[model samples]
Target: AQSVAQPEDQVNVAEGNPLTVKCTYSVSGNPYLFWYVQYPNRGLQFLLKYITGDNLVKGSYGFEAEFNKSQTSFHLKKPSALVSDSALYFCAVRDGDWGSSNTGKLIFGQGTTLQVKP
Candidate 1:
């Protein structure tokens, strides 16, 4: 079984400052990690993914994440924040080796609210 943890319920940052939303995961084998963002009344939008390759992955809206295998963590980062970036973020994971029967199943962490204030 795989699971994700988002320890922070909310992250507050001033506009133009760098922001980070923590995420960690556990899985039986190698993990397939992803990040998604959701607005007040919208569905989750895919941000980025780490299936393999580079330790650092970049995604939409100038967001990026670092994959640390040893620590089993994938933390989202942004060099600079924007007031428009304020939204709910989620970290999700699935076992890379899962068979077709388990397809489309993603374990997600509790949502984290990011507030960017000017």
Candidate 2:
């Protein structure tokens, strides 16, 4: 079975400090990893994705992620945290069993709440 794990339920960081949210995935074939951000009562917005190629992928809002194939991990990172950036983060994976025809259906982790203190 394919799955994703977000080890942390919440991450607290001071504004202007670096922030990271961890994620790990399990899959059979090549994994398509993605990160999404959700604000209060809103749908998740795409942050970044690791489909192929580069291990270090830059994303929206000055955020980036490193795809480590050996470790089976894709962790989201930001150089500095902002109060505005404090929101729910989700790590998602496209299960290959379902294939690309139905790629919209994503298997998501429980999600991590990011709290940036000013």
Report the C-alpha lDDT of model 1 over 1-118, residue by residue, as the tens digit. 6889999999999999999999999999889999999999999999999999999999999999999999999999999999999999999999988787767689999989999999
How much lDDT does each candidate structure score? 0.96, 0.94
Q: Write down the worst ten-residue block by lDDT for model 1.
A: 96-105
Model 1 local distance difference test score: 0.96
Q: For candidate 2, lDDT tens digit of each residue in 1-118?
A: 7899999999999999999999999988888999999999999999999988989999999999999999999999999999999999999998555555764668899999999999
Q: For model 2, where is the 10-residue window of minimal lDDT?
A: 95-104
Output the number of the lDDT-best candidate. 1
- Model 1 regions lying over 4 Å from their true place: 100-102
Count of steric clashes across candidates, in order: 0, 0
